[model samples]
Target: MAESTAPPVRITSFGYGHCRGGLRIPRAHLVLDLRTHFRDPHVAPELRHMTARDQEVRDAVLSTPGISELVEATAAAVRAYQAGPTTELVTVAVGCTGGRHRAPTVALAVARALRLAHDWQAVTVIDRDIERSVIAR
Candidate 1:
């Protein structure tokens, strides 16, 4: 018998507030909020409709300054990891009030950015809540 080597799996999770505690994986993880990209006055009405609890979470994420820096950092981390000795898997989680709008949009943007900037062998966007219910259930 021979031991076979497998490429490292990068599991990236992009979800909403409901997914906070549920994300646990043995891979690089990045948690982000879609609301960070919107200026307070510019926050979409759809996003503003979040429950109080969810709004609090979004507020926290928005309070952080220089979010573009964070996104850039995430991309840089992925590039740096892929350049290292081991096969790499990068997981980025983008969250908003719900899985329907902002989270998915941000996830798609991040995925597109990664694909454009890095030659990652694989890139996946997981909407943990909806994905679990729709696909995993």
Candidate 2:
């Protein structure tokens, strides 16, 4: 299959706590806040210390009730943006409470969805806050 000729896309996962002290969340054309709508794995002792890189964490987040649908919706949104009349890069910011679980998992899912749906060649996914110390709720 030929690679998509759409503009490049960048997806970032971040924690809301990291926005404290004058820090700003990454700018994006679309931002999905998973803090409230989704479950947090941090509250689970078994997954508390795990990042999205861990299969357990990814499974926990991906199994949430609305997550798969949201991933598809977000991928659709990115496709819409790409189909528009612009050549600028499309950025998507996925944020959760601490960025250790839900956000990064969803960001990665969205990247995969976009790749499969559109055969995109330049989608980049970044875990902006996954390595940071977990924020105490």
Candidate 3:
């Protein structure tokens, strides 16, 4: 297949305390600091251990009061970044306290939204703490 021309969206999940080498892409156009926007699922006993990949954790995080708007806003930001003058790749780091629950879910949501906003754009989601990443599109 031919390589995509549009910019790629790299959504990263990081922890607040340990951010030394969190990024694999090195540089980011925008870092969506989601640390303050929503409640940390790590606080809830039942959901603490469950990762954002779980259906329950995802639903719970998405239900938070302004999460939809936040994700939508991220898509809008990506649109603006698409039009800006720079390298076509757009890197966004979405961070929470632990990178276990909130950050991962939000990063995934942002990736999904970016895909919807710009169909031609590539997307990659990474969880730095866990060293897991969905390879580029």
Clashes of 3: 0
Q: lDDT ranking from best to worst?
A: 2, 3, 1
Candidate 1 Cα errors over 4 Å, as ranges:
1-16, 20-28, 34-69, 119-121, 130-137
Q: What is the TM-score of each candidate against the true structure?
A: 0.51, 0.96, 0.81
Please give the range of 10 consecutive residues that has the lowest summed lDDT in model 3. Answer: 128-137
Estimate the TM-score for candidate 2: 0.96
Per-model C-alpha lDDT, please? 0.48, 0.92, 0.74
Q: In model 3, which regions exceed 4 Å deviation?
A: 1-4, 20-26, 85-87, 130-137
lDDT of 2: 0.92
lDDT of 3 by residue, 1-137 (tens): 45545667788787664555543333566776667778877677797777887888899999999888999988788778877776667788877766777788888898888776556548999787643431121
Worst 10 residues of 1 by lDDT: 128-137
- Please, what are the lDDT tens digits per residue for candidate 1 over residues 1-137? 33323233343443344544755432345666554454431244554434222545345333446545665676676566556677545456655544544455445545666666644436666555433332111
Note the clash tally of each candidate.
Answer: 2, 0, 0
Worst lDDT run of 10 residues, candidate 2, spans 113-122
When 1 and 3 are scored with lDDT, the better candidate is 3
